[model samples]
Target: MSTIESRETSAISGDAGLSLIELIIYILLSSLLLSAMAVVLVNSWSTQKDVASVTQATNRGQVIGSAIERAMRNALDFDVDDATGTELRVRTSLGGNLACQAFLLKDGDARFTTSSGALPTLASDWARWENGIAQYASTPFFVENGDVVTYTFDIETDSAPVRFSGEAAARSTATGVSSPCW
Candidate 1:
């Protein structure tokens, strides 16, 4: 074969495939890129999970806070128990005989119970943190100054603890009304 033709053929063959070292380098680079992508994916998932947890905690706090505020605003008379200072007794305007008690259960469940008779039935679970992992960091309490009442509480979750506080004004006209507390 001619020298020029032989040289061209050799060059083409040499360039046809990667050497062992080049192949190893390529594989290393590809693995690094995949690893980076995997790290980014894991970080993104972690961030999303944190955001969802915070949002859920905030929603629960808002729901419970709003309910307590609404009930307090429509209440005739409300008192925080002197014994534990965690139990709030409220006489609601729904009826002169209707009364509600808000307290934290032994297992950290915040509950609301209404009674007009001998037995006080569980009306609702205001905040349920009874699974042990999640719980009420602080039981709800009320600070009453004349007609204005302030409520404050905290709920602990996996991500963080959520705090809630609000002020409500009792119905002035409903004052001095009698309600049954069982």
Candidate 2:
């Protein structure tokens, strides 16, 4: 009878704490949720980075291209040895009295030469060339004297490519001498 009474008392007692198995299961579920969230966050970050790089590269490329175009359009003097061939000399205005010259060369590839002390600065994801042709970072800006100036900006990073080649066109003091060659 006493044993029966003790058993009844034990059964009546409510559960006070979680069992080891329950605790373990809870921990595992929480860990799994956290891990999944981490993965999602990492993936988002990676995609964002890629997008940023591409944008930067493109902007850089545009700047270099625009600079070349402006120079070509503003050229006070120009010389085209042969239209069939890709070599020309152009003279244009620089900052203030400083004159800027550029030579364009377009063969199978393209390159350019500039008078600027520093090369063109693209958006921010490409390389700048002091001389010689580089891989087409951006489209060819212009062609003169077998030299090509191409500007490329990085799409994914903050780097740009400004490519210069050969010697810039010679600047002439003559303001309005309408000659075939300046």
Candidate 3:
């Protein structure tokens, strides 16, 4: 073959294959990019999970708080455990004086019952009344008063242990009487 042709052939062959140095660089870059992507993905997943848990706990707290407030506003008489504030009893004016009691367990669950041992409806997903105890694992909610009757709700879930709290005030059904909603 002509020297030019031979040289051209060798050049083409050499260009077709990667050298060891080029291969090593390519591998290192691939590894670094993959590691970066993996870190980002892991962080994103953890944050999303935390947000979901917090959102769920917040929603549960709101529903439970609303239900309790409604029941209390209409209550003829009420009793709360002073020691723990984890239990509540209410005598309501609805119909023929409905007596209800709620017990909150430390496991982040709750149960409610009528006076005669009848199971009350589950107002939300966080609580279930089985046998006689309402169980849950989390922090507690407390009542606060202002111009309107205000209460705070706080809750936590297994995945996210941070407490979520909010204030809710009652809305007065009639004028002159202030409601908490404001």
lDDT by residue for model 3 (103-166), tens? 3433445555444233243434224642212222333334333322233333555464544333
> Candidate 2's residue-wise lDDT over 1-182, tens digit each?
69999888777664667889999999999999999999999999988877786565555545445555566556665544454333334556555322343444332233445543332332122223222234444334333442322222222242344333322333334354323233
Rank by TM-score, descending? 1, 3, 2
Candidate number of the best lDDT = 1
Error of 1 at 71 (Å): 0.9
lDDT of 1 by residue, 38-148 (tens): 999999998888888777777876776676677777776676655655556677776533455454423345665555543243435344433222224454365667777
Q: What does candidate 3 score on TM? A: 0.64
Q: What is the lDDT of residue 37 in candidate 1?
A: 100
Where's the lowest-lDDT run of ten residues in candidate 1?
127-136
Q: Which stretches of candidate 2 lie over 4 Å from their true place?
A: 1-14, 77-89, 93-98, 103-182
Error of 1 at 138 (Å): 8.1
TM-score for all models, in order of appearance = 0.79, 0.50, 0.64
Count of clashing residue pairs in every prediction:
0, 36, 15
lDDT for model 3, please: 0.52
Stretches off by above 4 angstroms in model 3 are 96-99, 103-109, 116-153, 158-182
